[model samples]
Target chain A: MHEASIAASLIEIVIDTAEKNKAEKVTKVFVKIGRLAAIEIDSLEFAYDAIKEEYEIIKDSEIIIEDVPITGKCQKCGVTDTYEEMFFACGACGAFEVELLTGEELTITEIEVD
Target chain B: MGMVDVKAKILEKNYSKAAVLRDKFKNTCVLNFVSSPGSGKTSILEKVLVMFKDKYKLAVVEGDQQTTNDADRIEATGVTAYQVNTGRACHLEATDVEKAMAELGYDLDLLIIENVGNLVCPSQFDLGEDAKVIVLSTTEGDDKPIKYPVMFRVGSSFIINKTDLLPYVEFDVDKCIGYAKGVNPELEVFQASCKTGEGLEEIAAYIEGMIAKKKNA
Candidate 1:
C-alpha cells in the first residue's frame, strides 16, 4: 500500500538524476534499501511496475532495489557489527544499549539513462 | 559497459525537503499524533481544539487515504484543516506534509498532523514533528507497546485515551505503562476520554505548555 507512494518518489528521483546527466529517458535506477528500512522489497517492486506506467520516461525502466543489511554498534565493548534483524544488541559485548549504525537507508544512488 | 558505484541515500531527497520544512516550523510547534483506528484521535482533537482554539493558532493536516471526514471535523471545531489523501498510502511522508503546510499557511502557532490510523508506519516516518504522540485507547489490548515496542519507544508522549470507557473494557493500564516505560523510560503517558473529556485537560495542558514554552523561549 505505502510502496506505491514510495515508488512514485523513486520515479521522480530517478528521472531527475537521468535528466541532470543529460539523458532523455531512464534505463535503470539503482537504490540501496536497508534490511530494516521498514519497506518491503517485493511490494516496492510491484509498486514500481504499477506506478512507472504513469510516467512515460520510466514506463519501461527497471528498478533495481538492493537490500542493505542492518548493522549495529555495541556501546559497552565498542564492537560494531551488522545483523539481519533490527536488534542492536551486541553479539561480542552482550550489551543491549547499542546504537544503530546503519540499515535505515532508502535512497536512490544511480540512474542509467539514454 | 559495466556497473559503477552510485551509492546515495534514496530517502535523502525527501529528507532534504523535510529538513527545510522543519526549519520553517521552528516558530510553530508541531505534533504528529499516531494511533490505531478507533483510538479517538479525531474526537480527542475536536475536544482539545474547542478548549484551546482562542489561545492557540492551531492548524491540522488530516492524512487519510480516501475521505476528508477528519479535516471536516477539524474545521467544524473552528480550526483550519487541510486534507492530504495518500490514495492508498499508509503513512504521511515528508513531501505529502510539505504540500499541506504550504496550502494551510503559516500563521498557526501549532500544527497537528493526524496521521493515517495505523500504529506501525506513521511512527517510522518523521514529518518534521516537534514530538510524536501515540493515542492508546482502553478498547485495544493493553499489551500494545510490548507487541509494538517500536511505536511506543519512538513516541515522546503516550495518550491513554478512552479512559471513560475503562469500566466497559478490560484494559490493563499498568501493563501498558510498564512496557512503554521499559522501552523508553522518558515517555510521558496520559489517560483521557474524548467522550467524557475526562483526562483531556491534562493532555491539552501538556500541549499548551509545550507550545507556550517554545514561543516564550
Candidate 2:
C-alpha cells in the first residue's frame, strides 16, 4: 500500500534528476533494495509502473531492482558476515551483539537518460 | 544514452520532512507508540494523559486507517488529540504529524503520536518522534520481539502492557525482556498495567524527566 508512496517519490527523484541532467528521456533507473528493507519487490515494481506513466520523462523507463543481502559485523569478534534476519548471530563467535552493516538499504544507484 | 549516476535514497523526501518535523519537536519530548491492534495502547495512553496532565501540557496525534474512535477517547480524557486518518496507509508520515501538530497549536511540553496499530510499516516510517515506544501486551505472547525484529529494533522503549493479566496469562516476563533485549540492547523496558495503574507512575516520571531534560538543554 505504501509502495505507491515510495514509487511516487522515486518518480519525483528520477524526473528531477533527469531534468537537471538536461535529458529528454530516461531509459532506466537502478534501485538497490536490501533483504531486510521489508519491501516487496514485485509490489514496488507494480507501483513504479503505475506511477511512471504519469511522468513523461520516465514513462518509458525500466526500473532495475538489485537485492542486497544482509551483512553484519560482530561486536566482539570483529568478524563481518552475511546472515539471515532470524539467524543474526555471528557465524564466528555466535554472539547476538552483531551490528548491521548492510541489508537495510533502499537507494537509487543510477539512471540512464538520452 | 548516457548513464547518470544518481546515488540517492528513494525515501529521501519523507526523511527530509521527518527531519524538519524532528527540528520542530526538538524542545518537546515526542513519543510514538507502535503496537498490535489489541495491545492496550489507547487504554495506556488514557491513563498516561491523566497521570501527566498537571505536570506538562500534552497533545496526542492518533493515526488510524478509519474512524475517530481513538481521538474521541483521548478527548474524553480532556487532552487535545488530533486524528490523522491515513486511509489505506499503515503508518503516519511526518507530514501527517506536522499538520496535526499545527492544528494542535504550539503550547505543549509533550506530543505523543499513537501510530496505526501495525508494527511492520510504522517501524519503517519516522514521524519525527524522539522515541519509538512499542507496546506489547502479555496476551500477545513473549516471542513478539524476536518474531518482529524490525519493530523491536526501531523501538527505543518497550512498554509491556496489561501486566495485571500476567497471573491469568502464560506470558513469561523474563523471556519477553530477554527477547526484546536481544533485538534492541538499549531498549528501556517498562512493566505497566493500565487497569491497576501498576507502573504508570514510573512511565510518567520517566517521560517527565525526559521532557525536563530536553527543556533544560
Candidate 3:
C-alpha cells in the first residue's frame, strides 16, 4: 500500500528532526491526516510501526495520528459545513461552488524526543 | 523527553522532486493519465496519441506492476515509450518519473505518464504533471467519481470512456458528471469511445491547447 511509502517519508522527516536536535531517542511522532487524503489509519500505523524498527532512534517511538474531517465553505451562501461524502454541494445554497477548508492535510506536526 | 516542532508535509520530499520536474518541464505539457485497471487508459493512448505523434514530439512513460506490454503497444504507434515496472508498488512516484525522463529526455511537446492502474494511490503521488486526466469507462459504475473522490477532486479533466457501450449498460452520464462536479465543479468533461473513434478530436484539441499554452508561456 502507499501507506508504507508515506510512512517511510514520515520516518525520514522524524529522523531528520531528531538528528538536527541531537536527540538520543524519539518517543512519539504526531501527525495530522485529513479524511480527503484517502489514507487508512490502521495501515499507516502498521506501516509506521514496521518501518520504525529499521532505525535505532525511533525504534520504540509511537505514531499519534489526528484524523481531520472534511469541511468546506459554500462559495455562494458563505455557509460552512462538514462533508461526510466527497460531494461538496453547498448545504444552504445547493450550489456546487464550495471551497474546501480542510480534509487534505498530511503533515507531521511535532515529535517527542529525548 | 522534549517536544520538537516539525510541521512538515509527509510527502515533502516527493513534492520537492515534483517541483524540480515541473520547472524542467516548462516547455513540455505533461499529462498524468490515471484510472482503475482495464479502464482503457492504454487503449485511449493508443488511439488518441497517434493523432498527435506525427504533428508534435510526444512520448509516454507507462507504469505497471509488471510487463512492458503497454510500452510496446505505444511504441507500435510510432511514438516513443518507456516502461517502468514497479514490481510491488501500486503507484508511480516522482522518482520513477525522473528515471523515465532520463531515458525519454526532456525535449518534447508532450509527455503522458500512464500511471499504474489504481485509482487510490496515484492521486497522492504527483509526477510533475501539468494536469491529471482521469479516465472512467462506462463499464465501471458511474458513481466511481464519488467512490474515488480524491482522484476526481484532483483531476483537471474527466474522460468517460467506452461510451460505445452506453446503449448496453446502465451508466448514467449526467448523474456521473453531476457527482464529479459536486466534488470538483471545474472538471472539463469529455465522452469518448475508442471503438468508434468518437470524441477523439476534442481530446486532441485539448492536448493541443495545453501544448500551445506551455510553448507560449
- Which has the greatest DockQ? 3
TM-score (C-alpha) between model 1 and the true structure: 0.81
Q: Model 1: clashing residue pairs? A: A106-B10, A106-B11, A107-B9, A107-B10, A107-B11, A108-B10
Best by TM-score: 3
Q: How well is candidate 2 docked (DockQ)?
A: 0.64
lDDT by residue (A29-99, candidate 2, tens digit) is 99998876667899999999998888888889999999998888999999999877544668998777889
- Give the DockQ (2 decimals) of all models: 0.31, 0.64, 0.92
Question: Please, what are the lDDT tens digits per residue for candidate 3 over residues B1-217?
Answer: 8999999999999999999999999999999999999999999999888887888999999999999999999999999999999999999999999999999899999999999999999999988999999999999989999999999999999999999999999999999999999889999999999999999889989989999999998
* lDDT, candidates in the order shown: 0.80, 0.88, 0.95
Query: Which parts of model 2 are misplaced by more than 4 Å?
Result: B167-170
Segments in model 1 whose C-alpha atoms lie over 4 Å from true places = A22-29, A52-64, A74-96, A111-114, B95-99, B146-150, B167-170, B181-186, B196-198
Per-candidate TM equals: 0.81, 0.94, 0.99
Report lDDT (Cα) of residue B175, candidate 2: 93
What DockQ does candidate 3 score? 0.92
Judged by lDDT against the true structure, how good is candidate 1? 0.80
